[model samples]
Target: MSENASATELTSQYTAQVTADLERNTKEQERVGVEIAALQEQLASLQRDHTVLVNIQQAIDAVPVPDSTAPPSGNVPVPAPRKKAAPSGRAERTRPSKKTRPSRKTAAQPAQTAGQTAGKSTGKSAGKSAGKPSAGKAEAVQTAQATLVDLVRRHLTEQSEPRSAAEIATALGQAHPERAIKTTVIRTTLEGLVAKTQAQRSKQGSSVFYTAADPSRSAATARSEEQPEPADA
Candidate 1:
């Protein structure tokens, strides 16, 4: 009887796992579908812009450049040049005196540039030395940085199931609108992470998904989610 009970429990567990995976897969499909639709819309807009640009270029090409021989539309006549009297031999001999200037300014320019560079370096060093961040500020600085891979890895860790690159890009973009997150960048980062074994990649039919490096984390998350919440007192 115990053997039969164990078998039934095992079957039930498998069923639950299968169910969870199925549901996750469905959600992923829907999310990717939405991202694909958005991408298509963007592509259409870009194509329209491209068409407009091509038309403008063709129009520009069709217009011939005006030539010098052509008369002006205003019908303005060219003015004759006025003749000037030539200087006397004495005046011509007494040309403006050319004084040789000392290379003071030219020589000083390099010195001034060097001084400015030194001053800038000194100021930077002084600021870095004097205006040190407090422990909190230092931590915050480390927390908010330009490392996209770190950001993507952290994002993946928080997710229960694998996520598509488009979905990840969209989520990150919405969360950090100023950053202007892009799906191509996300996909490239994900590929690098996978190569490093810092992230896991899985495919469902034509769709690819990424998740945390740890394979078992997703299973654990699913189990936890499946667990019922405690009833109200």
Candidate 2:
């Protein structure tokens, strides 16, 4: 009888211990999940900030630098030439000749990019325009896009991990709100730019983050082996 009682007690103790261990493991798992969620949120926020910064940097790069000699504001006087030109019978080349002209009508002002829906100079104008990107201004837009794409590529390369488009845009917007970046525009630009950059698209569950890849001579070289080689090559 005593032996039977001892066995029962031992079994009970083992069952209690197993239960305790299971509960402890569950709690630890919950904690880990919570931590992961927090980290993901933090990472997303950083990505948005990065995107905003990239857009702003692109805008800064795109905005043509005005001829300093022909200051937009005439308040600042340009220095007068010290020596008068010695006249040859041929028309003398004037130092103050208006050689440089802005390429576009709004060359004096800022230009817009594709998918940028906001005010002409404000974020509002770009939002309303469903108009396609112009063929004439394609070169200018491409130039701006390239600058922004390069900035984003560099930003990703500098980061230790992948980043979400929203996070990238938020970072860029915060860095340069004056540029008036729209989240949609940022998202679209990043997607298009990624094609050129050959950045890695990492999927954590359903969420996608872009991881910067090493830039080779061309993006084709950076492509995954799964992708087919270009026909031209």
Q: Tell me each candidate's TM-score.
A: 0.34, 0.31
Candidate 2 has an lDDT of 0.57
Maximum-TM-score candidate = 1
Among these predictions, the greatest lDDT belongs to 1
What does the lDDT read for residue 208 in candidate 2? 79
lDDT of 1 by residue, 66-96 (tens): 3434432433333445446557866765554
Tens digit of lDDT per residue, candidate 2, span 1-233? 99999999999999999999999999778556544544454465567666756665565556443232332332333344456566676445554455573345444233233213222234333333322223324444343322344556666777887888888877776866655556555555555544444566777998878877666634556556458767984
CA lDDT, every model vs. true structure: 0.69, 0.57
Clashes of each: 0, 26
- Model 1, position 226, has a per-residue lDDT of 88
State, as a TM-score between 0 and 1, how close model 2 is to the true structure.
0.31
